[model samples]
Target: MQINCTVIIQAFNFLITYLFLRKFFFHPTVQLIKQKDTAKKILAEKLKLKELAVSNLVAKKNSDLDAFRYSISQRYQKPEQAVIQIEPNVLSKQEVIVSPEVIEECKNSILKGVHNAL
Candidate 1:
């Protein structure tokens, strides 16, 4: 069988044009669209992750606050040590705090047993 020159030339032209478009136009266009789609998907996922993180942080903070409130509400949590701790220069409603001279005299009377043993 003999091939026609016109048909063969037309077939060659079609192949070259298709290859050129695929290499220089269609492939890059498709790749660009794919890249854009991937970027959009990534951005959406990032936004979702950020929202979840914020919600988790808020939930954790609320839980901590609730725990703290519950702890404080449970009892007369004022420590015994605080009641015993002494501050300088304090005066009662009827009594005044004298200087160290009077304080030492009062201590001797209060601890009379220790003084006798010594």
Candidate 2:
């Protein structure tokens, strides 16, 4: 088979066109895809970092709340202890100071309640 000059020229033109299109179009498109992938990766990493920061803040707030609760419990415990200590002493030292008239009134009220119940 004899080689034709037109065929050789056509093959060369096709190769040039392929290389030109790859350089101008395909390479830039691939680069743009790579850039988008890189941007997505960076954004994902930033989101993870922010999530970690928020979790740490929540943990800190919970710990602070626990400490506050502990302090309030301690403060209330002192008042409760003082009241317990004072209660027995106050009860032991105090005497019932009912007068004769008040005792008679209490008896009369009790008799009235019994009569109403019957």
**Per-model lDDT:** 0.83, 0.84
Candidate 2 residue 93 C-alpha distance from true site, Å: 30
Off by over 4 Å in 2: 78-100, 103-118
lDDT by residue for model 1 over 72-118, one digit each (tens)? 87864654332233456555677776899989986976576444444
Question: Lowest summed-lDDT stretch of 10 residues in model 1?
Answer: 78-87
lDDT of 1: 0.83
TM-score of 1: 0.51
